[model samples]
Target chain A: AQSVAQPEDQVNVAEGNPLTVKCTYSVSGNPYLFWYVQYPNRGLQFLLKYITGDNLVKGSYGFEAEFNKSQTSFHLKKPSALVSDSALYFCAVRDRGWPSNTGKLIFGQGTTLQVKP
Target chain B: DAGVTQSPTHLIKTRGQQVTLRCSPKSGHDTVSWYQQALGQGPQFIFQYYEEEERQRGNFPDRFSGHQFPNYSSELNVNALLLGDSALYLCASSPPTGRDTQYFGPGTRLTVL
Candidate 1:
């Protein structure tokens, strides 16, 4: 079985400051990880993903995340926070062990990123 | 090049009633998946449809069902709804192959009283 966890329920940061939201996962096989952001009453918007290759991956709106194999962590980070970046962030995983091309995504509970201006 | 879209942005229904939610996948996408998001929780997968067939499903019960049309549009039908069924229903779509990166719609807010 595979699962994801966003330990922090909420994280606060000031505009222009760096920010981070932690995420961890468990999978029997190779892991396909992703990060998404959601605005009020809106669906999730794709931010970034880690399939393979480089551990660091960059995505929309200046957001990025690093996939750590040893720690089993994939944390979302931003060099500088913006008020517009404030939203609910989620971490997801796809179990490669299940079957190739199976698009089932297991998501974390979610972390509310509150960026104060 | 439109993204995924869902109809009936907001809905209210009583217990034991049935509700149907609609979804149109992103252009060129052939797979549609349904998810249920309870307040303060992550979205849970319901099922997936491809080529007008039920391709995959999650832990949801039989009461939760769906249909995919030839146009790649889909509908989610919930029977004998319970108050616990009140949640945000999300629709996502992806290409038929490749990495299978899914895109989501704004979602339908269903309130079961």
Candidate 2:
């Protein structure tokens, strides 16, 4: 079965420093990976995606992810973290095995990033 | 344009009670998807509706059902709700091509007591 893994339950970083949220996925075929962030009491906000073309995909709010096919990883990163950047992050992949247009997605457990001052 | 919207920002219900949650797709969107998000976990796909029909369903039981209207709004019906059913219910909308990205609504927080 296709699945995603976010090894860290929580990541702590200082404000103004670089931050990385690691995610790895396992799928039968080429993967359509995505990143989403959720703030307290809010629904998820799309960050970025890697369908094809670029290994490095940039997204909203100064976020980007690098997709590595060889390692089967798509880790989200930011050059400088802000206190507002702290939130729950999720990695997801469209299940290609399903109907081409179903839009079903398998998501990782999620990683909480805490940026302190 | 308005983003996806869900009604009843929060709800509290007892076990065995049936509940209906509504969602209005974003303007110009034709597909609506429902997901269940438990505390500390990622949202799980419940189902997707297109053209007023259920195009696909997740592993959730039949007790969890839904309907889509001509206006592209949707509703999720949960019958005989269990304590486990208490979670954040999210509604996402996509364009005619369902394979594209999904934009989520604020979500309804259901608390089963």
lDDT of each: 0.91, 0.92
lDDT of 2 by residue, B63-100 (tens): 99999999999999999999999999999988866456
Clashing pairs in 1: none
Off by over 4 Å in 1: A97-99
lDDT of 1 by residue, A1-117 (tens): 799999999999999999999999999877899998889999999999999999999999999999999999999999999999989999999755223445688999999999999
Distance from true location, Cα of A102 in model 1, Å: 2.7
**Candidate 2 CAPRI-style tier:** medium
Best by DockQ: 2
TM-score of each: 0.97, 0.96
Residue A25 accuracy (lDDT) in model 2: 96
Native interface contact recovery, model 1: 0.56
Reference contacts recovered by each candidate, as fractions?
Answer: 0.56, 0.59
Best prediction by lDDT:
2
* Interface CA RMSD, all predictions: 1.3, 1.3
Candidate 2 pairs with clashing backbones:
none
**What is model 2's native contact fraction?**
0.59
